[model samples]
Target: QAIYNIRNNPPQEDGACKLCNHQTIQRADETEEAITNRLEIYNQKTAPLIGYYEKEGLLKNFLSLIASDTIAEIKKSLKV
Candidate 1:
């Protein structure tokens, strides 16, 4: 994957920070409570920095999807 390639030859700005795409492939009805719990744990342990990004207007939330769908979602988010 492109991500793996980038990991092996990382960009200069890539310090201790990580880059990733997080996805959950399930409808609301199919989502489990455990998923919420896991997100809570991640929020507690990993999301404070995201709050900082949000404050800076650099944070974005994308719906889960494949490559084509991801492009569509991005376009939608950008109002393009």
Candidate 2:
């Protein structure tokens, strides 16, 4: 979704990497098609790993981390 958003409506020249906090510059030559292809490849590679962890009941959903206390939630989940 993020990539698609960028592809369609790219950021102004002042975007930054969320993780590294570094300035980001979109390549002028990169196309939406290229980004979509890359995203598909990423999904294909990661889907099986995600499924494996889920099947083993080892996948810990951290999606609620922003709304709840992170440490407390992690501890509570670990107790089970």
Candidate 3:
């Protein structure tokens, strides 16, 4: 769906999708080690918070889904 949106929408004046193009350059230049380091840092930061939430019975787990269905599933899970 995101790909479809990108294909159908007109590009900005710079010939890029402002929302999507921002990450392309940085991601393209990132090395595997950099990606792994980032993930390790992220996990270290979030693991304790996730554990706290779980202890408080505030953590909700959901299966991962395709991008197109994620919003719908989240809304449904939230009963919104």
Model 1 agreement with the true structure over 4-69: per-residue lDDT tens digits: 223465433533324343321334533457668788889898879888899999887886658888
Compute the lDDT for candidate 3.
0.65
For each candidate in turn, the TM-score is 0.31, 0.47, 0.45
Cα lDDT computed for each candidate against the true fold: 0.62, 0.69, 0.65
lDDT assessment of candidate 1 = 0.62
- By summed lDDT, the worst window of 10 consecutive residues in model 2 runs over 1-10
Backbone collisions counted per model: 0, 0, 0
**Predicted structure 2: lDDT:** 0.69
lDDT of 2 by residue, 1-80 (tens): 13424656544445755545566665654767887888898899977898899999999876553655776788888994
Model 3, residue 33: distance off in Å is 2.3
Instruction: Rate residue 43 of model 3 by lDDT.
Output: 93
- Please name the candidate that would achieve the greatest TM-score relative to the true structure: 2
Ranking by lDDT: 2, 3, 1
